[model samples]
Target: MIDAHIHLEQYDSEVSEQMLRELPSLGIEALIAVSMNLDSCIRTQKLATTYPRVVRSAYGFHPEQPLPQETELSNLLEWIEGQPREDFIAVGEIGLPYYSRAEALERGEAFDMEPYIQLLDQLLELAARLDKPVVLHAVYEDALIACDLLVKHNIQRAHFHWFKGPEEAIARMIKNGYYISFTPDILYETEIQELARRYPPELVMAETDGPWPFEGSFAGKITHPSMIRDVAAAWGALHDYNPGQAEEILTANTKRFYSL
Candidate 1:
């Protein structure tokens, strides 16, 4: 099975090494290691290199964090351009701001979106130029803007990871044939279950977003790639499929989406 999205670099060295050691035992075939910034991109690349088949790197600045300096962004782009094409799977963990913006506003902190939109444009342009799939972090109104930008750029292979939006936006994503992933939250979150039921299986994938944690049955557990199997089970139950069959379908969707 494939963990379609995760931050393998976020874990401590001991945990990371342990997880790597257990990959085969857990039945996890591969992981799409999504980056949060230039440092994360570098670390993810190193992990992929060390673990080869166990990790596929995806480089991008995560949208929730403070935007990077122009020089930093330029360096990151240069680094991406210099890498072997087969080493990275996509340009991802990138999108317009949402949750973080809300939190900042609630705290009366200054929140600006102009820079974020600009960054998203540059990332999308890179993805289009590279002809690679994109993993998005856009949600709610941000999702609407992201959809518009994707359409404008004519990017056909996009993955809206852990997506959440109104029905209309969800419909648009389905119509556009974009992929969306469900997390372990689906095991207990009614909304996630409904989302799995609504989105077509071919366009659906599973992820643990490991080391980020989760609630319900996943509460108090250090998130792991192995948790994705439970997500697949939830997807199966929601979609009226055999759990193993759902896992196979999700694995196929992830492989094709990332061209693994």
Candidate 2:
């Protein structure tokens, strides 16, 4: 099994190394380590280089970070432009945070879609030019809006990890052939389970959203790539497939969606 999305940068170097070493024993063959900041992009890319076959990377600014300054954005664009085409599997973990804390939102300390939209628009253009898929972080109507933008740009390959949105929005995403990834929450989240059931198996994949623990079995625990098997188990239960069969289908769907 593969953990389609993980935050390898969230752990310390020693911890990260230990986790990666243990992932295979837990049935995880690979991971898409996503970046949440400019520095994290570099760090994640380095990890990918170190592990090559075991760790793939997706680079982007996460929504929790403040909007980039002009020079910073330009520098990031330059770095992205010069990156070896195959080094990154996608452009991701990017989008707005609609439910951020009041103070942070007011202080503009958090990423604001209003300002970052232009940056994301540029990213979409870049993704289109590079022929890479995008991993999105927006949820609810925000996810719908991101989908609208992707469609408007004719960017066909997009993945929404840990998705939570209205039925209409989800249907639109399905209609557009966008893929939605599930997380360990499937073990206890009835809403997510229903969502898994609503979407066809082919359009769904499982992820751990690692370093961010889920409730129930993993409450208060740091998430790991290994937990993806738990998510797959829940998906299998929801979709009426045996565990092995569900893992296979979801794994195939993940590889197909990301062009891995």
Candidate 3:
């Protein structure tokens, strides 16, 4: 099965190399390596070039970090614009800073969400112009804003990875025919499992979001693309489907979404 979203660039070089070698045996096919920033995009592109059959890159800024300066933003946009169309699969790992702003507010720090919203709007505009699918990081209230921007730009091919939000947002996404990916947490997190139950089988896929760890049965282990097999297992269990069948459905959904 393919990992619908991962930060392969974040993994240690030796570790990633070893994992790539093991993928065939693991029944793992390809990874959608989403970028965190310009540097991350560069690294991801290199990995994709090195293993073109295994690593597919997605270029965009992650929202958890501070907003970029004007020069930085311009540079990133230009860089993404210059990349060959086939070089990256989507505009990804981009959205409002929901977790960051929530943490800051709880600590009595002031946080402005508008700039992040504008940033996402610009990135969504780029994705629309390029006619590429989007991999989003938006969750909770931020997801509502993301849905609005997606509609504003008529960006229909959206994949909300490791998503969590209210029923309203979920209904909107389902209605819009957007896709969603399940992480390994579906094995243990009730919230994630509930989402698995809600999303349509054809509109859903599996991911590791790797180089970032997971808890439950995944606790303390290095995240790996092969773990998505377990994610499919858990998701299938939720809907009373067996593991092999689950993996096949998710794999097809991923291929259909990314045009892999």
Candidate 4:
């Protein structure tokens, strides 16, 4: 099975090295290591080089964090493209700011949507140019606008990771043939279970988003890629499929989406 979206570079070096060595034994065949910033993108690239097939990099700025300087964003785009295209699988963990927008408002900080949209547009253009899939962080009300951008760019290969949105957005995603990935939250989150039930297995995959931590049974435990096993199990339960079958379908979906 594959962990569809995770920040492997965020883990401690010693810890991540050991985890990467242990992943295959735990039934995890690959991970899409999504980046948060330029530094993260670089580290993810090196990790991908080191781990080869086990760790694939996805380069992009995360919207939940502070907006990156225009020059920095430009440099990242250049750096990613300058590298061998095979070094990365997609452009992502990128999208509009939703949770951060609220936090900025509460702090009286200016939150500009223009820069966010501009950044997303550039990333989408890069993905379209490279013919690579995208792993999105877009959710809830923000999902509608993200969908519009995907349509605008004519980028059909998009994965809305850990997605939670209104029925209309979900319908749009289904109609667009976009993919969705569920994190370990599916084990205890009723809303996520409903999403797994609503989205067909053919267009769904599993992820840990590891080192981001999680609640429920995952609380207090070191979030690891191995946890995707439990995620797949929960996903199977929602769809009335067994764990083994879920792994087969999800693995195929992940490979097809990222061309793994």
Write down the lDDT that model 4 would get. Answer: 0.89
TM-score of each: 0.98, 0.94, 0.99, 0.97
lDDT per residue as tens, model 1, 129-186: 8888899999988988899989988998999999888998899999999999999998
Cα lDDT over the full model 3: 0.93
Q: Per-residue alpha-carbon lDDT of model 4 for 150-256, expressed as tens digits?
A: 99999999999989999999999999999999899898889888888999789998888889889999899888998988888899988888999888888899999
Show pairs that collide, candidate 2: none
Evaluate model 1: give its TM-score: 0.98
Question: Residue-wise lDDT of candidate 2 within 146-229, one digit each (tens)?
Answer: 887898789888899999999889989989988889998888888998898898788888898878867898988878787888
Error of 3 at 160 (Å): 0.4
Q: How many clashes (backbone N, Cα, C below 3 Å) per candidate? A: 0, 0, 0, 0
List of clashing residue pairs for candidate 4: none
Which residues of candidate 2, in runs, are more than 4 Å off? 101-113
* Top candidate when judged by TM-score against the true structure: 3
TM-score of 3: 0.99
Model 2: lDDT to the true structure: 0.84
How many backbone clashes are present in model 4? 0
Per-residue lDDT of candidate 3, residues 1-260 (tens digit): 99999999999999999999999999999999999999999999999999996999999999999999999999999999999998889998899898899899999999999899999999999999999999999899788999999999999899999899999999999999999998888888888888889888989999999988999888999999999999999999988989999999999999999998
- Give candidates' CA RMSD values in order: 1.0, 2.2, 0.7, 1.2
Identify the superior model by lDDT, candidate 2 or candidate 4.
Answer: 4
Candidate that would win on lDDT: 3
lDDT of each: 0.91, 0.84, 0.93, 0.89
